[model samples]
Target: MLLMSRTDNAVQRFIFENTDIRGEVVSLNNSYLDALEAHEYPEVVRRFLGELVASAVLLSSTLKFEGLLTLQARGDGPLSLLMVECTDQKSFRAVAQFRDDIVEAPLQTLLGKASLLITVDPVKGKRYQGIVPLEKETLAASLEDYFAQSVQLQTRLWLACDGQSSSGLLLQALPASAELSADARSESWNRMTALAETVQSSELLDLDHETLLVRLFHEETVRIFEKEPVRFICTCSQERSAKIISTLDRKEVESIIEEDGQVAMDCQFCNHQYVFGKEDIDSIFNEKPQIH
Candidate 1:
C-alpha cells in the first residue's frame, strides 16, 4: 500500500489513555536539508547528522525549561564530532566534523572510543550534563541507555535517515502512579513498544504523524496533541561575530586585517559569513579596549 508524503518538519506528542506511556513522532524535511547545505558532508556524516537532529528534536520536546538541549558525540576516529542543538521553542541546528577523507563504515569504526554528551542548559536555572558511552552500534541504543540510567524512564527510540530526510519515534514510560500498578504499567509499556517495534523505516520517513500513529496504535486509545513546528534557526549574527574579534588581542586583530584587508568570520553551523573591515574592527576594539 502507498503512503502519503510525511508532514513538514514537525513533532507530534501522544499519550496512551489510562496508561503511563507517552510518545513523540518527528519528521524532518527542509530543516534537515538546511543544515546539510552548510557543508559538503560525506554520506556517513549525512546519515548520522540526520538521525542526530531527529533525536535532538524528540528529546527537546520532553523538556519543561526554557533553554537549549544539546547532544554531542566526540571521539578519536574519522568522525570527530557530531553535534545537534534544540531549543525549547522547537528550533534546531546540527553540524558534523569529520576527516576530509572519511568514508562510509560501521558506526564503531567511524567513532572510535566515543562518548555521547547530553547537556540541558536552562535559560534561568542550573545547567546539567550527562555522559553516556557510545559503545552501542547505533545512536538510538546509546540514547536509550542514557535514559535508563539517568531519567529512570524506560525509553526507546527508533531513528532513521536516508541521507536526505530523517524521522524518529520515541516511546517513554511515564512515572508509576498509585492508580496504575507497576505490573500494569509494565504490560502497557511492553505492548505499546512491541507494536512500535514493527514500524518500518520507510513508513516513518513517508507517513504523516497522525497516519503513522493511527496505523500503529489503532487498537489502543491514543490521545495526540497538536503538532509543534520545528525550524532550522541558527543563532548567528553580525553582532555575535563582532564579539569574537573583540575577544582577541589588538595586535592579533590588526595582523589579520593587515594580512587579508578584513577579518572574515564564518558560522560553522549555518555557513554565514561576517566580514569586518578596518572601520568595523576599529569600532569593536574601541568599544572593548580591555581586549589587550
Candidate 2:
C-alpha cells in the first residue's frame, strides 16, 4: 500500500520592499512523518522533534556555504538529546532520545537544565557554534534569544507542530539598507514582529504560505521568492557503517563475530541495520585505507 500526503513541504523567503526585514515560512507534512517513522516515540516527544525539524528547514536559508547546520539540545532529564540537521540542498534528518517513563511536564521540566547548540559547518570557512541556555517555554523563544545575545540581531520565531505535521515562521530585522534612519528601521522591525505575534498555531499549521502572509501582512508590501522543497533524508550507508567497525580493535570484532556469527549494527536515525561477516570484516580492514 502507498500513502499520499497533501501538505506542502517547502520554504518561502519573504522581504518587505521599504523595510530592512526578512523572514521565512515553512510547512512539513509527510516529510515530518518520514523523520519519525523509524522509531516509536511518545506524543510529546514526536511533537518536539517535529518543531525542531521545522525550525531547521526555516533556518537552512542562512547557510551561505555548501555545508550543513545542526541544532542540538542536550540535558540530563527524560529528553536527553534532540538533534536535527539540514543542508544547503534542503535535505534534513532528525533524532531524539528520551526516557520512556517520563511524566507529563513542560519543556523545561522534560529537558532539565539543558543548553541549545547552534552549529554552522561551512565547506571552506571556519566552523561556528553558539550555545544558548534553554530556559524558555518553547524552542522558538529560546532561538530568538540566541540571535539577540549571540548575533546581536533582532529576530523572532513562531513554531508549532501537530502530531502529524509541523510549521514555522521567522522574522529577522536586517540592517538599514535604503539610507533610512535607525529609528525607522527599528520601528519597522517592531511593528512587523508585533503583527506576527498575533498568529495562532492552527493558522500556521493549516493555512498555506500565501494565505498566511496575506492574513498577517496585508498592509505591508511583502515580496515572496520562489518556493523550494524540503525533504527528509538519512545519510547512513553500509560503507560508513563498515568504517566504524574497521576502527574497533580487531580482537574485539573477532570475538563478537565468534559468538554471533556476524557483527550486527543499526543506525539510530533511520533504523537501518548492517551486518558484517568475517570475510566482510577482513576486506574492510585489508582492502583499502581508512577514510577520515
Candidate 3:
C-alpha cells in the first residue's frame, strides 16, 4: 500500500520514481497545542510558533543521525525570540518570547532584521551551526535560502498553521550521482521544484496525505513511505537546572540567592521552574576549591 493509514500523528516522506526529488509532509497537533499551553502568546506569535514547529520537524526528517536540530530566530523587536527543537526520536519542543506591547502583525513586521540560526547537535560528535540572515519575509522563504546556502540544494518549503494544528511541505532536489550527467539531474530538479511550488498552504495543512499527494503529483509517479510520529518531549529537569547553577561562580550564585531568596531557573521551553536555596548552592560549590 503506497498510502499508509492515517495515524493522526505522523510525518510522511515521499519520493518521485523517475525524478531525483524527495519531500516530507508533517502535521503537528497535540505537540503544538502542548507548547502553546505553556504561556499566553499573542496570535501573531502563536502563528509564528506553529510555522516554526512544522519547519523544524520537516528539516529533522532529512537527518540520518541521532541528534537534535534547533531552529531559532532572534531580533531586536517586539517579538524577541522564537525557537523549535527536534530530536532524532521525532520528539520536538518550541517556545517564543515577546514584549508586553507586541501588537498583532504579520511575521515580517514582527521580526524585522532577524536571523535564523540552525544548530545540529549529534549525540557523540561535534555540533554544527549555521546562521542565515532573514532576508526573506516569511519563514518558508528564509529556510529555502538556508538550504541553498548551506547544502547547495534546491529546496522549497510551504509552512502553515492554525491555532490547533501545524503542518508543512518540503521538497528538495537530490544531488546527482557520479554515473548521472549533471545537466540531466539539473533539468529534472528544475521541473520537480516547479511542480512543488504549486502546493498551496491550505492543501498542505488540511488535506489528507493521499489526497494532497495525488493532487500535487498526479502527473508524476511517486512513492510514498510510512509516516513517523512526532511528539512534544521536553529535555528540561531539576537535575539539569542544578548542574547549570553549579557552573556559576560562588559569588554570583550567592548574589542570586541573597536577592531572590532562592536561585530560580526556568526552562524557557516548558516554563518549568527549578528553585535552589543557599544551602543547595553551598553543597554544589563546596567540593571544588576556589580559583585565585
Candidate 4:
C-alpha cells in the first residue's frame, strides 16, 4: 500500500499474489489542471483530456520502452483531435485541437470517423505505431478494443474524469507460468475483471491507491508497489524550436523577419513562444550545411 496522499499526482502498480495478473492505478491533480490551463477547452473536452492523461500514464507504465509514448485521436468533426503523451520517466503533457463551436456530444459524434493512434518511440530502437478506427461510445471502450486486437494478453481499462481530477485503473493478464494451468489463468482473469467492473467513477477519483485497491480486491492478496510521481513536463526548448525553424526555407524566413522584425514559433502543447532575431536566424542558417 502507498503512503502518499490521495490527491497526489502519482501512479502505483500492484500484482495479484501467486497469480500472473498485474494492475495499475493513476491519479492526476495538478498535472491535469496544468494541461487544461494551457488552453480554453470546454468542460467536456477537459474531462476527456483528463482521461487521456490518466490513460497515458497508466499505459506508459506497462510498456518496455525507454522513450515516449503518444496517444492521438483524430477526426473530421468539431472535435478535431485529442492527444496525450507520456514518457518512460512518468512525465506527460496533453493538447487538444477542435472547432470553436464544439459542444457536448457522444465520442463518435464529436469525432466523426475518428481513429486512435498509439505511437511508441524509443530513444535507441525503432518506433512502433498502431492505428485502429474509433467506433465506440467512450474513449476507454475504444482503447479496450485496440488492446484486444493488438496484444495477445487480456487487458481492461477503467477511466474517469470530472474536469477537476482524473484517474484510471488498468488490469492485464500476463503469460501463465508452468505452475499455473491455462484454465486457472483464465478463471483468475475473469474473476478479477468482474470485480473491477463494479468500480464507480467517484470511488476512483476520491479514494487513494491503497483504499481503492482494498475496496475492490479485499478478498484477494494484492502486493502494492511504490508510487511513482507524475508531472506535466513539456519537451519544448529553444533548441528544439530552432530545429523546426531550420526546416523552413531561408528566403521565406528572411521575409518573415523583415516584415515582423522577428520570427516567432509557438508550441501548441505549452503555448511557449520562441522568437528569433536577424542574428539568431543568420547563425542558424550559417550552422546548417547548404546544398548550394
Each prediction's RMSD over C-alphas, in Å, is 2.2, 3.6, 3.5, 2.8
lDDT, ranked from best to worst: 1, 4, 2, 3
Question: What does candidate 3's lDDT look like per residue over 1-292, in tens digits?
Answer: 3544433556899998866778998987777888788889878888899999989988998888898999999987888899999998899989998999999887777887799999999988889999999878899999999999987888889888877788888888776653187787778777777777788767776777877888887888889998888889899987777777767878988988889989889999889998888888888777543321
Better of 2 and 4 by lDDT: 4
CA deviation > 4 Å runs, candidate 2: 1-7, 287-292
Q: What is the lDDT of residue 225 in candidate 4?
A: 97
- Regions of model 4 farther than 4 Å from truth: 1-7, 289-292
Cα lDDT, all candidates: 0.91, 0.88, 0.84, 0.90
In candidate 3, which residue ranges exceed 4 Å CA deviation?
Answer: 1-7, 287-292
Model 1 CA deviation exceeding 4 Å by range: 289-292
lDDT tens string, model 4, 90-109? 99989998888999998789
Backbone clash pairs for candidate 1 read none
For model 4, which pairs clash?
A: none
> Which scores better on lDDT, 3 or 4?
4
Tens-digit per-residue lDDT, 1-292, candidate 2? 2323323999989998888899999999988899899989899998898999988888778556788899988988999999999999889999999998976677788999999999998887889999999999889988988998998888899999987999999998877785289888877888999999999999899888888898899999999999899999998889988888878888899898899999989988899999899999889878644754
Using lDDT as the measure, which candidate wins?
1
Angstrom error of the Cα, residue 273, model 1: value is: 1.1
